[model samples]
Target chain A: SQQGEEDPQALSIQEGENATMNCSYKTSINNLQWYRQNSGRGLVHLILIRSNEREKHSGRLRVTLDTSKKSSSLLITASRAADTASYFCATDASRLWDDMRFGAGTRLTVKP
Target chain B: DTEVTQTPKHLVMGMTNKKSLKCEQHMGHRAMYWYKQKAKKPPELMFVYSYEKLSINESVPSRFSPECPNSSLLNLHLHALQPEDSALYLCASSLPGQGPSGNTIYFGEGSWLTVV
Candidate 1:
């Protein structure tokens, strides 16, 4: 079963704009990770934010986690057409075996 | 290397054919996983191997068997699969003994499968 649901199932924006995707999960988690997948390819790990961390940034990617709300948001600043892909959020829920559950994903298209 | 290598990037098999998908990781990760993904959908966990042991099976069918011979090699043996089972099969691995929340998981480029 899927654990997380990403809002804005699909988004399209002009280049240089900022794209934000939100995710909400049902259970408590140890950490939240965001990944990007190009068409027909493997997932690329973007950034990880632990439960205790409220925000993190990597390059143009900024991730904010709200443990109290069991939600997280990923922001891609200065988006480019190369950023076109599906973004997914995964949560561990502190499982011993590392069974990460992924969200439905947000399809972001940066129009150049 | 840090990559997960998956073999037969594309596969087309008959319903009665028996085929195997192989994955290898040299990053010394102890946990390996198999996930099935339909187009535009999130990948679903099918199996997990921790320390070369079968740790989690998400009630996958009997026809889909997973083998982890060692810490570096993982294989998914397929037999008598239906057309509906055709999808992108992904293999991923993470650091030794780390929970999903503990480390980043590296994914293969997914084997595209089609069952006729």
Candidate 2:
């Protein structure tokens, strides 16, 4: 079974608008990571937030995690048309190696 | 460097044909993974290799065999595949540990497989 589930399957906005995506998980996680995937391409690591940390920022990206709610949100500020891609949240619930499970993903379209 | 490279970016094979997908990483990551993704879907975990040994197998079919030749190379051998098996095969690698850095997986460009 998939560990994470994302909401608002699709979103559309202007180039300068901010885009937000939410993800809910079923189990406890040591870390939650966000990845971006272009069409017909592989995933690219975006940001990772530890369970002990509530929020993290990188460049124009902001990620928030709520362990109690078992959810996480990824916010992309000042989005660009190049930022249009599918964003997925992956949860690492295992204590051993990388046992990351990903969500269905939210497709974001930034119109120029 | 920090890239996980995969060969044969696109492939087409018949149900009876045999093929192999190769992945390599030069970052010295000990953990490697294989994932299958369908259109508009999340990538599914297929296999995981740690320290050149198979650590996790998600009950993948026998026709899909994964091999870790060393710490830097991983390969997936395919045989007698069904059309439904056609999808994007992704190769990823990361450090082996419990820390946040260890969980950050670097992915290759992926191989688009079409089983006819």
Candidate 3:
């Protein structure tokens, strides 16, 4: 079963625009991580935000975790054409340590 | 090396033909995983190996066999696969225990399998 679900199944924007994707999970999670995939290829680690922390930033990526609402969001600042890809959020909870479920993912396309 | 490598970037096999997907990682990660992904779907956990031991099975079909020869290698054996079984076979690795701080997974390019 999938623990996390990403909203806005697809998003398209210009090269300089910002891309924001949201994810919601069911259970109390220890941490949530985001990944990027090009086409049908494997995933690439983007950023990780823990339950204890409310928000985090890495380069142009900003991740915010809202445990109260059981949701998280990934913000890509100044998106580029190369940033166009499928973004997925994975949730790792307490009970299921080894079982990390991924969301359906959000497809973001940055038009150049 | 810090990356995971998989062999046979693409594979085509018949319904009755048997083939195996190989994955290797030199990051010394204690845990390895096999995930099956269909088009427009998220990767599904098939099997997990921790410290050379099969930890989680996810109730995957018996036709899909997983092997961990050593700490640095993981293999998925496929046999009698159906047409719907054709999908991307991805290999990922992470640190054994938990916590996103120390346990971040790295994935390979994946093996695209087409069953005909």
Candidate 4:
């Protein structure tokens, strides 16, 4: 089953703008990881934030986790046309490796 | 390559056809998983194999059988599948040694299966 849900099923932005997408889950999570999937392709790992950490960043991406709300957000600063893709957030429990579930995803289309 | 590889980028089969999806990884990982996704839904776990042994099965239908030939290869056999079963099948692998604190999975270029 899917453990999380991402809001704004679709987001369109102009290049050089910032794109923000949010995800909310239902259960306690050990860690949350974000991924990017291009049209008709596999997924690529973007970033992973542990339960102890509140915020993390990688390149042009920033991720924040709020355990109380069971929600997380991914912010892409200075978005580019190449950043156009579907983003998914996956939650993994602290128990086992297979105890992970992914959210629906948010489609971001960045136009130049 | 730092990636999981799945064979047959695209597949089309009829309701009575029998086919198989293959996945390979050379990342020296101990665990592999199979996930199925519909048009706009998220990937759902179907099976998980750890240390070359089937460890997790999500009560998936018996018509779908999974096989692990070796530590580097996995296969999913499809038989008597419904048209609704057509979707993107993904394969992922991860080193499940560090527990949850460091659990990360790498995915392959999923195989798009269409059952007509």
Specify the highest-DockQ model's number: 4
| Residue runs of model 1 more than 4 Å from their true location after superposition | B99-101
Q: Is candidate 2 or candidate 3 better by DockQ?
A: 2
Q: What's the residue-level lDDT of B65 in candidate 2?
A: 99
Q: What is the DockQ of each candidate?
A: 0.66, 0.70, 0.62, 0.70
Tens-digit lDDT track for model 2 on B7-99? 999999999999999999999899999999999999999999988988889999999999998898999999999999999999999987756
Candidate 1 residue pairs in backbone clash: A98-B100
Docking class of 1: medium
Model 2 lDDT on a 0 to 1 scale? 0.93
Residues A33-62, candidate 1: write the lDDT tens digits. Answer: 999999999998999888889999999999
Error of 2 at A40 (Å): 0.7
Say which docking band candidate 4 falls in: medium
Could you tell me the lDDT of residue A76 within candidate 1?
Answer: 97
The residue pairs in collision within model 4 are none
Q: What stretches of model 4 exceed 4 Å from their correct place?
A: none
What TM-score, over all chains together, does every model reach?
A: 0.98, 0.97, 0.97, 0.96
- lDDT over C-alpha atoms for residue A68 of model 2: 100
Least accurate stretch of 10 residues (summed lDDT) in model 1 chain A? A92-101
lDDT of 1 by residue, B12-91 (tens): 99999999999999998999999999999999989999899898899999999999999999999999999999999999
Q: Write the per-residue lDDT of candidate 3 for residues A3-100, one digit (tens) a residue.
A: 88998999999999999999999998888999999997889999888889999999999999999999999999999999999999998766555677
